[model samples]
Target: MTDTTVRSTGRLRGVLDRIAEARRGDSSESLAAVFLLIATLLALLWANSPWGWTYEAFWHTHISFTVGGTGIDLDLQHWVNDGLMALFFFVIGLEVKRELAIGELRDRSQAMVPLTAAIAGLALPAVLFLLLNPSGPEASAWGVVISTDTAFLLGALAVIGPGKAERLRIFLLTLAVADDVGALAVIALVYTDELHWIPLVVAILGLAAVWQLRRLRVWRGGGYLVVSLITWVALHESGVHATLAGVLIALLLPVYPPKRREVEWAAELTKRFRQSPNPEYARTARLGLDRAVSVNERLMRLYQPYTAFIIVPLFALANAGVALTGETLLAAATSPLTWGIVLGLVVGKFLGITGSTALLRRKLPPGLTMSQVAGGAALSGIGFTISLFIVDLALTDDEALADQARIGVLVASVLAALLGAVVFKVAPAPEGPSMELLRPVDPRRDHVRGPVDAPLTIVEYADFECPFCGKATGSMRQVREHFGDRLRYVFRHFPLDEYHPDARQAAEFAEAAAEQGRFWEAHDHLFAHADALDRDGLDAHAAALGLDVERLEEDLRDGDTANRVADDDIDARTSDLPGTPTFFLGVTGQTPTRLEGPHDAATLIAMLERMATAASPEAPRS
Candidate 1:
């Protein structure tokens, strides 16, 4: 049998592998969702059942310990909330970092709509709650409504059936991250307890230990965990919420190159091998490769299991459980915390997202259409998990008030999920996955490759029928003229069929030209005369570009290009270029920056010159 089959039947058997396989499944989100629903239902059942005594005792049972003449006391629930919840926050921190670095939030324009919507969604609720409960101590927890529960929201979306673009998921995720930033800010500024010196000193020492361990290149995951636990205890005693300790420690932890020097050496070796002249040079690069493999094996052993199967799900189980009762529901409706959260989530989120998005379409760089913005904002109110946690933290002293907030979250979140589902279900489905269009196809193969020799690569996301895209061709040609051999231009379709009916067909015709090595020629011809982009114009453009007439006609009849065009539109959302003619400038060393809309030749040349000079080794002093 093969080693892969042997491993499948290995000594540890299938437990870890099963967990890995489960994670790989798309249904993992659905499972987490089922867990959430079960947890919530169990909380209600436990609260009202004859075994309610057991439930209360289970959560309320206290544990205590003494160290250095100081005593620490906590109930089982507090341990779970203060200790286990910190790990959840750390994972969230990781997700936030990943998104900002390489995921959806990497592009400024891509992030604008969601970021703006999150702000508006947050502001309206807090303002409404504050106005409703002005002087009440319970009103401090208004931040609860500001968060979007990514798992629950996305899971709800998944149930609506397939054919949805990944861009829709990505757009919602960006908004959720924006919501998380808002929530974290609220916790740091508004929810912290008063500082205490003695515990603070201990907390700082714990943090110092973690930093030193990391600096010394320690890759032992257990060491970090032990330090994180100690640090959490110190922070809890130091007057800050213990959960925030996880957030603080996670911020301090380095996620770049691993501690093993061999790993770094292996990466450098890989790069060198890719650039090397001789195949023998690459063949000889084995010892470094072996060392890198060993280091990765060790690192994975230390961290993977604890993070996936334990931390994330345990946080969901503990935090998701909230008592639901008639009393709780009634109190939630009347309480300022409840109404503010409910209205803020339901009314405020939809309005703010839809409104600011509409304004952006008119004034700012470009924005998602009214239909898409409306659908996304409507879904923003699915704030169950995080909202519940904030409510629990916000009214730690008043059990009654906290219960009311939970009721509000349940009602509002359910309403939002239903409404958002209907909106997306009714919204028109585009032709294909949006990613295929954003990432270019290869010339000889069935894929798209970026420019090979140009010093600076300019990738354009365009729709043939888009007037703005039509106007941008001249600007791009001017860039090529100014830079000569220094610039390469790449094209990807981003048709907005919601408003432009002919956009999809126009994109297909361009792809047909691509098959004949006349993509650029057909691109210019079609855009230069967009008003005549119908069947007759497409045929003339094809003939003008010297493409085989019969093949082009046959391909257009098949309509197979729709999926490629649709995929590009979805992928473009992650880059924050929700509209046409969104230009990305990629170079050897510098970061990728997008140039939006139709700029004049002079503006384009100046920007290109700046980018080109920035990539140079010895350019300027000032």
Candidate 2:
């Protein structure tokens, strides 16, 4: 019998995996559906409920960040949607890199369905809206139905059962990503009030400076942040939607490395150290090494919390608030724009997506099942967050229209979410899982053995008896291949001596092998047989690697190698390496940049490129 717990976890796992995967593809609409639902609900409730007046009053209250006599003034809502949302766009930018690099968009075959469906999904909705609203005042608000908010959609799906969750999740995500492309187009073409070329130009220059810094591998978060402020201001003043500044700056960021040049430089640097001649040089080198290590430690501490705590949560809190009241509901239903949006998302999304998917599945070779597509299409209507955003933006001049749109989005999103849950529950699982099962990748080993000069470093720390460590090797190998020399892979020992009684000795065996110029070989052997990392197994691995077993045994007994392994663990812990296969890419010599967990090559490449340019001399000068 299928393990029920496994199935449930698999579903949750699929949701996260899809999020990671969809970040690369432009087709993450399912997530949007859920985000829209929550945002719209919050917005509707904030507008109509008892708290509605308070919410509105609160949002309208102005806040400012001032320096000297100058300050930026914005209402609380503006801070959320414009200021905080920039970080959201930054995440979107990161996902765009992943997709274009190695995800679904990377393959022409995989891309065709989403691109075609996205085009149809977008076009069908606008045409449907035009047919419904005609030339009346509501015509211009047609952009509301065209959006797909990934966060809201996925969040809803998380509540549902998990059978065939992976497939449906993938379908909805790619579809939504397609919708984003169209949404961005609408913003650029239809939304702007006037062109402020001079400030816009300044924004571009600021962005260019950021790009230069990224190329130089300047992993200084503050540096790009300062540039982002200027760019947003310039764009805002330029009569472009200031939020577009987020998108624009995100695009200019360098996400890939400078090819083999950096890799070769690192290897050469390492080789030079191995061949150092002068005794005096060693003393000087020690000081330099110490300084470099300290610099890396300090940089890591500074960057993580700022992005995680300051940027992300602020965006969420600000954007998550929307008022709901009885007056708003009446206003929402009466408003043509909001009505159109509600019907379009709730009804139009299901019809357009499901029908189009069915027609396309019959005609196209690369297609998911109709049931899966239908379930996914249902999920696509969970456009609460982005839908609310567009509703606010689309009907800025007409409060009635905006209120109606929020109601429509909220109601439609809920209906869609419920429908998606029922359908996914009944959908049959295919025999073979297509998307690779994600195995955890260890960071400790990758951290220690991984090169200092390497653009991306993956450190794996593991106990030889740990089952998770055994599973991680395949996943990491795939990463190594994808990144090639761009990554400097490392392996370290944290044998969890308490968990597995003999694992400490096994770690010592691997350390001893490193001294004998065969650390990698022994490292692989230990993990390959992690189930049996006892003395017999380690000894066999040593013998297999053609090491002098007698000498290796003697070294292991002395405990010196074990002490060194302990030091490696201490280093990893100090660096905030979260778990096995925790990754840190120095990106450049300037600072420490870390991406925790089992990340794809694309993220690593993007981080490396950003670091390189950010640290360049031309960065600040520009």
Error of 2 at 438 (Å): 19
Kindly list the per-residue Cα lDDT of model 2 for residues 1-622, writing each as its tens digit. Answer: 1233223223333443344333323353344433444444454456557665686687779998888996678898887777766656555555454445434555556466667777776777677766767776578778877877666666566566354345455556666766776787787688786897898899889888878977776653567778888988887778777777766666655443112223233333333444674656555433333222212222322332343334434443344443455677677667666666666776677788877766667543222467767776777776655566666666678766655665676677777778888887788755543221111233433334444455555545566666777776766676667656666666656656446755766787777787677877877888887765544456567777899876775565443574466555555543434555454445444334455544555665565556656666364211
Position 323, candidate 1: lDDT: 58
lDDT of 1 by residue, 170-206 (tens): 5677777788878877876778868888888999999
Q: Lowest-lDDT window of 10 residues in candidate 2?
A: 433-442
- What TM-score does each of the candidates earn? 0.61, 0.56
The deviation in Å at residue 206 for candidate 2 is 1.4
Residue-pair clashes per prediction, in order, are 21, 88
TM-score of 2: 0.56
- For every candidate in turn, the CA RMSD to the true structure comes to 16.1, 19.2
